[model samples]
Target: MKRLRISLTAQIFLGLILGAAFGCFFPDFGSQLKPLGDAFIRMIKMIVVPLIFSTLVIGIAGTGDFKKLGRLGGKAIIWFEVASALALIVGLVVVNVLQPGVGVSLPAIGAAAGANAAATAQSFSISMHLLNIIPANIVEACVKSDMLQIIFFTCFFGVALAHIGEKGKIVVECCRGIAEAMFKVTHIQMNICCAKLFENYK
Candidate 1:
């Protein structure tokens, strides 16, 4: 019974069975539980910016060499671009070979105003995604929870800290301590969240 009580996998399995039973018997009731799922996701998202900022700052400050950081950054960017281009080329090749869209009866291009609106929204989303890399305001970037900007700022700040001589060592040590504490906290929270999620399912 103790083993049963503490086992997360068992709790999750039990929860899934119960939830499926509930949905099967009471669709409307199950639908109302959607908020629980959304709340869990939101909770996870709320942790992102701080976690990234702390870890990045610590990593950069601890490095002790600006040239090493620059080399790492350059290599990372090059690898990212190469991987992205490869993915794109592979997708295009596969799509051309499969031609899944060729014979499918698509909705008439001009028929649906709603479809056009959706397409426009998608385009806007893509454009915003690209533009968001440029920080409007540092505070806004942090508040909006932009991971990339937070990482960039933290890394740059860390490098500056490293260059500040004796004073920098104290700051770097503090940042490292903070990063470790935050990591531990994050880990504990994740375990708690997972336990709760499993319990809910059970």
Candidate 2:
């Protein structure tokens, strides 16, 4: 007998197909798996900040050019704005074209849910968001898992590390190690994630 191997991509694809079929055949059971889905998302989110911080710090430090970093940051902001605008336009066009919500009756959410939603809506402030990105304390930002703050702090730290020259190489190397470890962790998570998602649906 010959051994057969399945690549990760193929395994993930198989999982997706299986999950979809299982969900369609057993909608009630599939709906119960929402908690598991959320848990998996949380697992990935836990890895994201550290991975981003370590990798970006290493990248910015390696370049050792503030000008280059500034340019990169500018381009990133422009890309985000452009992509967001395009997404909004496309979404509006699609919704208008399809009129998917027409004649659709949605279940009314609970009073508590509406209250929470209103509270969330009230919390939006552009000035506050910009201030938050600067993060008064890096430790608090990490604890809160505030990505913008983490990125802001990491970029500043990287530039500072770069300015120190030889003294900072040691730190950069350490960050490189952290980045590699995070990558490995993410890989392991991905392997388990597909299996776990399938198991949940099953």
Candidate 3:
């Protein structure tokens, strides 16, 4: 008889099903497993900034042509905005159509917290958002995982390296190496997340 080997996707699917079942049948016990999920989320978040910075730096530096890089950046921004707008429209349409909260009755837990959040959101301005794109301190940006600031810094660094011509090849090579290392680390973190998910099932 041949033994069955479950693929990672299948394992993930199975884990989701089992998790749902557990949550439905043993709400208290399932809630206690929140820490496992939180840990996995934190680890995954830790991978994003460094991985994105390294890859973006390598991509821009390797392009070698300033005009081509500018065109690429323009296309990327346009695509991102268009895609985001479409996604938001779809979500709004579905939510309006389904009215998911229509039948739900929940208690308001924190009136003060809600008011503070509303005030903060209302005070948010485009100028503030633009200012945030420029990192005051890069180390602080990385620690906070401010993706836009990190991306801005990385793109500038990459452009500077590209402009330096052959003199910058050594730094470009270093960025490429860092990117490869980050990729491996991301893969390992993903595997660890899956392991933690499976452990929660037990």
- Highest lDDT: give the candidate number: 2
Candidate 3 accuracy as lDDT: 0.84
RMSD of each: 6.8, 5.4, 4.6
Best by TM-score: 3
**Sort by lDDT, best first: what order?**
2, 3, 1
- TM-score of candidate 1 against the unseen true structure: 0.58
**What are the lDDT figures for the candidates, one per model?**
0.74, 0.86, 0.84
Off by over 4 Å in 2: 1-3, 67-71, 74-78, 100-126, 196-202
The Cα error of candidate 1 at residue 129, in Å, is: 8.9
Q: Number of clashing pairs, model 1? A: 2
TM-score, candidate number 3: 0.78
| Candidate 1 vs candidate 2, TM-score winner | 2
Write model 3 residue lDDT over 1-202, tens digit each, in one string. 4544655677677778888998999999999999997887888787788788878877898899888988998999999999999999999999999888897889886999899999999999999989879999999999998888899999899889888999888988887888888878867766665644333221
Clashes of each: 2, 0, 0
Off by over 4 Å in 1: 1-30, 78-136, 196-202
lDDT per residue for candidate 2 within 103-196, as digits (tens), equals: 9899999999999999988997898778868988888988999888898898888989999999999999998999999889878877887763
Query: Which of candidates 2 and 3 reaches a greater TM-score?
Result: 3
Off by over 4 Å in 3: 1-4, 103-123, 195-202
